[model samples]
Target: MAAYTQDAILLLGDSLAQGKFDRAGLADRLACVYVRKMDVINRGLGGYNTDWAIPVAEQVLAQQHEQHRVPRVQLLIIWTNFVHLVNMVRSPASAYYSPNTRVILITPPPVNTHQRTDRSFADTESYAEAVKEVGAQVSVPVADVWTEIWEAAGWDELACEQFLFDGLHLNAAGYEIVFNSIMKIIEERYPEIHYEKLQTVFPHWSEVNVNDPRPSLVKRRVPIV
Candidate 1:
């Protein structure tokens, strides 16, 4: 087999998961913590819902035969609405069924009705609940970001303004809640792949031999456990 470098964590979702607008988005935060341990791949698309994400996932995820050449996806963080996407990876009948890949579902944050007239507060709440339901049915761990942000805002729909900048998209404070929620799930359900538990692919600077640094620079494989 060819030399394997680093394993990866793929983040898939809409704009919220994309984190292009906010520097403190979940993907960025995870990268910071998981640096050198695992590569974080963000595949979030703007304004895309469940329908659009399914096809894109098909294209992005490697097929069974191509798995050898590509970096293994150790963790897949899905923020989009999916029962199909989960099936694609978890179902034995599917081509993308990756037994080694761990999956986590994330709910969209609550909408701020006070600042936005397009989306209703009830509707957004229902959407979050639906994502949780899908996660339950599919047996995938859920981050439940909706509930976390709501509780952070003291359960007031109007008070969600503190987290959301434009009533729809999240600001720094909002993304902080998201990062925390995802980390909690990782620590509880997927501790093996947690940053603290894994070693870096490359040796730390101090581990390098001053007389022969080349030998110390060789990458090491970080086992899941």
Candidate 2:
């Protein structure tokens, strides 16, 4: 295993979060933007809801004792909906609590019942709203993806096909919205960790002196606000 040389932005959620097939998925976009600044770890599991996520989080998150060896989770982005999951990390009594870690809650995208039957439009909408409520209760930032996509779809359920591939999962267009929403949240809530504000772990090649390249290649700790 690679040594813990950088902090991480851990992403946890359901299929919407996993999105291994979508090149424009949230994880992919975040990885691209956060490269060299922070490692973006995707722990998104397909078909997993809040209930299934609880047990999984315990395993994925480092225990208090393991803090010294593991990369610190500086930012956590949860695309799942549930208060328990949020409290598990934010609550002072929880074992995984990290006071320095910032959290961002993301609402699920809108569902179009017409193209999909397993889920209902209203049900998904409720889940999205619940995420926002949890974010408010815990004082974490929320990426209100539901409302943003709904508006992008012109408030018409059927029109969501422009972004969604099967009225359920997102396409490149949909992922773009998710990526934009996340970037906006980061800009407003965690400006210090923003990609633009952070310096690369190693100096740019242009800064390296030809006769003394070893010193410029040394990795440096990134300052976080």
Candidate 3:
């Protein structure tokens, strides 16, 4: 197989971003959509709060300049706890600093106390709100995951459990909600980068003329404007 490099969509957060509950987490789901257009880099630090993520995020950005193989970061999605959301969004030096790169802040989903003893839905909601507020202040997109999942469950606490694996992490269904929410914002705000609108590397097999495949197989680069 031939090896190639493309721009990246960076996913930075905690366990949820790491896909602890669902191995095919946000990054995986996005990779399926972007296909060959971009690489989805999951820099999820399990059990990490925003304080730790700040320094790490800077390192990732700095290292990007040193590594030629590391594609430029086109989009950065930060899905951390409320405490970190503010710093991540407000700090101008983080990954979101680039004018060429877009950013999306994802608030954590509501937790079900019945199934998990560590977190509470009430606290999650508060944190989610802070994320939204920061996003507004920074003019960055914010995905109110807590609200989305809660409404999807018809605002029923017990019904909300369907979206979680252990009341803390998300299951497949829960991840779907997060994926859709993020995609919706991307479609609305960054339509140029939308996967559906992106051109594939090569033409479909049926579209290629066996006698002159190269002419049909190669596509010009689609600049992000």
Candidate 4:
């Protein structure tokens, strides 16, 4: 694999960004030769929107330079789950979209129509659009998750009772689907390439096993989706 001799990878975004859904340890499952379990940093703060994401990303990006690795940011995953928050920061120059980092915006998962009525669907679609617009301004790639869920199960089934035990977050299989979806995007775009950088090798996959007790939810899925 082509060596990305970088160590730090900051994943900054909202609840979905926190990656609370993927019990499969999705980030650990990435096929990046430059990145490994230890290298991927979960900077995802539950319930945060892009308004909050910018500062966190800035803080990390400002002092976060590398000595050995060439900054293996083969992928920087982002998702926006907050519209009210982004609205609060519309005119602020401190918004999340910045040119300093490589980025990919995952369309925030769709809202559960059954669980959310009262214009939540509008809010979610608006949020998704806002995310895409901001990412476009900075020339970042957009990961179309809106299509992913809609095409597969539609909002109702994707947000069905069995799919979400808590009526918000997905169960194990749901999480697996989410994780695989994101990874598949990365693999498709980055197209992992093998290279022998003298002493370099892929980092050890996470030691965690499937039987290990599941981790807690770091971020709540909006609208019980």
Give all TM-scores, in the order shown: 0.95, 0.96, 0.84, 0.59
- Name the 10 consecutive residues with the lowest summed lDDT in model 2: 81-90
Question: Model 1: how large is the Cα RMSD against the reference?
Answer: 2.0
- lDDT: the better of candidates 1 and 3: 1
At residue 208, candidate 2 shows an lDDT of 90
Ordered list by TM-score, greatest first? 2, 1, 3, 4
TM-score: model 1 vs. ground truth: 0.95
8-109, model 1: which lDDT tens digit per residue? Answer: 999999999897554788889999999988889999998998899988999989988898889899999888767999888888889998888999998899
Q: What is every candidate's alpha-carbon RMSD to the true fold?
A: 2.0, 1.2, 3.3, 11.8
Write the residue-wise lDDT of candidate 4 on 23-102 in tens digits: 44334434343332225666667776567765665555433234224443434566664333232222234343323334
lDDT per residue for candidate 3 within 126-167, as digits (tens), equals 888888887887788888889999999898877888999888
Candidate 2: residue 179 lDDT (0-100)? 91
lDDT of 2: 0.86
> What's the residue-level lDDT of 98 in candidate 1?
88
Q: Which stretches of candidate 1 lie over 4 Å from their true place?
A: 1-4
Model 2 spans > 4 angstroms off: none
* Pairs of colliding residues, candidate 4: 1-195, 5-69, 5-70, 6-69
> What lDDT would each prediction earn against the true structure?
0.88, 0.86, 0.78, 0.49
lDDT of 4 at 12: 58
